[model samples]
Target: MSDVDSELMAGLARMLAAGQQRRAARAQTALETLRSYERRILREAAVMGYVLGYQSGNLDGRTGIGGPLDKNNRIPPDSEILRRVIEHCDSTDDLYPFLAAACDRRRRSITKARRWPGEAGAR
Candidate 1:
């Protein structure tokens, strides 16, 4: 091949490598963001469980049941709640709103359940 052809091939290879690197970096960033959201979701679910009087126990890897204990014997979040929340979230943008709405609904339900039957404005 002529000098011009060789140079063109070399430039094309560099461009391809650069594009691949950019894509890889973007993928890594997305993975990290998802992991962050996962942690947040678990924490929120745990809080919800605590509010609802779920007791902590030994770590058992079960969902919708008592969670296994950590080193301090504290149970993690309820896996079932986490699974449900994640099911409704299609992206990071949806996570915050979904989590907030879920928590609010839980709060309302708890409040409604606590009222006496004849209490004013009680459902």
Candidate 2:
């Protein structure tokens, strides 16, 4: 090939490599964000579960009354809930709205229970 053509091909190759690297970096960032959201959602779900269980007297001093607990009698991670959420969601765009709404609802419920302890038993 001519020197000009060789140089042009080399430049194109470098551009392509740089573009791929940028794409990879963006993908890594997106993945990290998704994982962070998942962790936050799981943590919120766990806290909500604990609060509900405590109010309902399940965790007051009882064992084996209500649960999908492990042998150690601990509430397991909410992988099933996360899996179902992921299955129902078409994309991360959809996932965030749904998860955010769920977390908001749980937060409100916890707040209400705290403000009116008597009303908690009515639920």
Tell me, by TM-score, which candidate is best: 2
Candidate 2 global TM-score: 0.31
For each of the candidates, give the backbone clash count.
5, 0
TM-score of each: 0.31, 0.31
Clashing pairs in 2: none
Look at candidate 2 and tell me the lDDT of residue 65: 42
Top model by lDDT, which number? Answer: 2
Model 2 CA deviation exceeding 4 Å by range:
36-123
Q: Return the clash pairs for model 1, or none.
A: 58-68, 58-69, 59-68, 59-69, 60-68
Model 1: weakest 10-residue lDDT segment is 101-110
Per-residue alpha-carbon lDDT of model 1 for 30-106, expressed as tens digits?
A: 33444465557665765686545544332333434344333353544454445444433323423344333333332
* Cα-based lDDT at residue 120, candidate 1: 38
lDDT of each: 0.48, 0.49
RMSD of each: 15.0, 15.9
State the lDDT at 92 in candidate 2: 46
